[model samples]
Target: MAKKKSGKQPIIGICALCKKESTLEESHIVPKFVFRYLNAHSFTGRIRTVAEPNRPLQDGKKLHLLCSDCEDLFNKDETLFSNKVFHPFKKNGFDGPVIYNGDWLNRFITSVNWRVLHQDLQKITTEQDNDKPLTPEILNTLSNAENVMRSYLLKERLNLDVLENHIILFNEEIMRELFSHPHAIIQGSAFGTPVIMNKDAMYVISNLVGILVITIIKKHPEEIWLNSFVSNESGEIPQSQHFDSPIVTELRKFEDFRQAYIEGISKNQLEKLQEKIRKDPDGFKNSETYKRIMMDRKLK
Candidate 1:
């Protein structure tokens, strides 16, 4: 019999909303386009180097082990956003500022702040118990964060049209080639909310963008897996087609999109980015604009 090469199911945590035990896929802290600028010209198995962003980006692999349903929801949004904004921007080198989902991103980011509160609570309370038991408060903290990230994605990952206009913007004309995925949701009372993407959906996107930049700078990586899946001893079955959606599959296979981004962003773009930073100041940190997104903020 052939032996398995994969690791013990990537400890994908439970989806906070659904409370399912699963692997949390590796999600990017920043989008791929940002990094791609620093990388090579394209994903054509080539690599370039840059100095401004310091070192080369990672192998353009920003992942977060997530269950089928959560992955599906987020990827759906990714496809929509990529086609409308990212793809055009990367291909044409369209100069502009970062776009976002205003209310939803900010609201959910608050939950990440709560996670810190929960952690602090555990730290302070854990000393009191010789054998610390998982308490409701701790659970609430994590759950709160997860719900914030997962619940409002549709609100956050839209283009300016849907965002400013508050429209659904669901179209079938550009469905393009379909992708593969499975049908899965969170189960078992979750430890907390499942939030791979913070209030600013960019947390994941920026990192991927950065890595893609890195790939262009250094060299393109071999593979780019989007919310990959696996089975386990706990009745988990290995599947790829999340809900059997073609859109979902296309998202999972976007190695070139990431590579193109690296080649696309120009030095001129960086200058403008700096100007935006100066204008915004704290706004960037508060907004999804920051490439390295930190989830721990003060919960309101």
Candidate 2:
């Protein structure tokens, strides 16, 4: 593995990706570029994380996960994704279907899934048994998927094997159900985390504004994820998409949580947010936030 010297002192630890006892780099679970775009377009120029909604974050969540070499390996795919899909989709707000050809999209989604899964496992390791429902078999499956993804990211494995990577656009279909709580759907845009549904499915979900990346580890028999699977070589991200799984119920539950959290925001912070929007009416109107509001209004 290649190494680079930095002015800061290196912190030695077991690197999550390469499994090497070497210097680790602070890695973002979701790439920093996604958070950068969210921050740049937000009225306050800051994001409120799900963990601490009151505290504004300057970037996405990060951890001392990957070594420098592994970080470099992930960056190649991140750059491709940010350039080819993320920027253009965010800029136009999915005006039309987007087509992609090559292996980068698959690799990029897998990298994000791997990071989220690794972080989740790290958390679960320290937690008590109160967090039930994860049977030994399910846990083993999850761990195995993580290993497979890590190997795939390292180029040690050629493909995801049985695991699947899906890109579910938060297009008209899903957004329609969320019309009543437009703000929550808007807030969800910046959210990314691991989701486990019953003993049937374990997946990493990244809501990059309008785009939803779902990487599946365990899939239930009845689950039907339509037109969302990212092909190894080529695929099209169409405007119309459908998701038929218990995951949809989980999503609605999260939207309710977000709505409740939004309702609980302190009056002072709400005033500040209002003031920011007030000062930039034209900018706010043209912003993604405004567009989502309009979309919801039309749906209603």
Candidate 3:
């Protein structure tokens, strides 16, 4: 493991990835580049939390989770993802379907999944007056998934049994539409919050980059035709697919979120909403139902 020069000794704790007692480093749940894009477009270049838009958070949301060795392992994949997939999409923009290396895509998905689980674990352990406790079953599942992903990242494993049956969707139009608004940029609307569903699946919605990585922890549902794309060994993504029911549903969700941030919340209402979110952060962030009536209303 590469060591960094610092005055203070490394903080000793169980690394999230390796599960070994070691010095844990502060790791960003969402990659730093994502925050950089959000801040660069904002007037003040500061990120505001969705729960509390008034409160600005620096360095995005990070926690002391992984040790240096594990952190370095993720960094390697993060660099490949940023260079090959993320940067290219951001620069030239995707006009049609693009093919990605299966190995790299798998690593990217695993890395995001691991981070999401780590963040959730941190919240479950640290938050006050928590409504929900992290169940042993869920913790075990996440830990097992993390171990499989760590092996895959280190080239100790090849198959992605824990992360297989995945569907990655992209819609450049939604991203362009959201980033057009200055308020949306300031609120970090492009960086969609990660939502873990039922301990069976997770969604890492990156509206900024126009990508959605949906991981199936268990068997893929028959109703979801998108699974057909990944059912085979080949990793070719279509240039465009018909806006099926799922696609429409997801796009509408993004639209609702896009409009919500573009239409700023009032100071008084924001305070109340913040309080509600504080009480139930996961519920508030993960709500799928969008009230169309709220579109007409604005903060005073």
Candidate 4:
């Protein structure tokens, strides 16, 4: 018998969501459109990730987690969301509360949250060093949440039983609170990640530019998440919502990280950015970034 060559095998395995054995696709956990939006509106047409502040990122995180069929399933809802809620809110100047059919909205929210949760679980399993180690009970809860979310995404379940989805609009009120750290808020507006609060809470928060999609996996009673809860039936994403939760503190920490990144930006990069603005002063003044800066200044 011929000796088998030993090398790293291709990522040909089962789809995480669908669980079908096939060649997996490089799937994006955070929708790719989010990165496009960030680049389009950014001053230099470049965006940086929270993990690598100094490195210019062309896309969001991706893994070989899904097959093409499963990927397409996600794309349908993502397109609906981007066209209706996301683009309208971010680009076309339509502010909430925007009405949406429960079907697409629920799928979209579930898809994003499921992807985040799924990826996090994989990370925890493969990597030994966890900042906040999951207790057996918490781990089991997360595993169950992931399974339910997957079933919901795959249309196997009619609803996410105990799971809750919410959209918090970045309107005048929330913007006011975040005004002091304009850079942080601006960066955050384009970011997406999971927010795990030890044994007390767990959430996957996606900032679709100005709109925040928060998937509540678990929560403590004291954590007040009001008005924004997305129902399974048709609902409206309200202009105003309240979040008195540890998630707010997590957001602040993210803002601080962004702030530190901004401060640590090399002088050469700043000069280059300034030069670019100088070359097209009129464009710079009229850009959305400049408007945000002015908004921050006025609020401060």
lDDT of 2 by residue, 133-229 (tens): 4678778888999999988888897888998888865655576665466544743356677778766777788777767788888787888876788
lDDT of each: 0.32, 0.78, 0.55, 0.78
Tens-place lDDT per residue, model 3, 28-144, is 877877777656554344666545555655557677888999888888767876776666765565555556654666676667766775566556657733566556776677666
Q: Is candidate 1 or candidate 4 better by lDDT?
A: 4
| Superposition-based RMSD of candidate 2 using all C-alpha atoms, in angstroms | 4.2
TM-scores for every candidate against the unseen true structure:
0.31, 0.88, 0.64, 0.88
Deviation in Å, model 4, residue 240 alpha carbon: 3.1
Steric clash pairs (candidate 4): none
lDDT for position 87 in model 3: 63
Give per-residue lDDT, candidate 2, residue 215. 86
User: Model 3 TM-score?
Assistant: 0.64
- Over the stretch 121-158, how does candidate 1's per-residue lDDT look in tens digits? 44545564557554565445444433443444434522
Model 2 TM-score, all chains together: 0.88
Please give the distance, in angstroms, between residue 195's alpha carbon in candidate 1 and its true position after superposition. Answer: 18
**Clashing residue pairs for model 2:** none
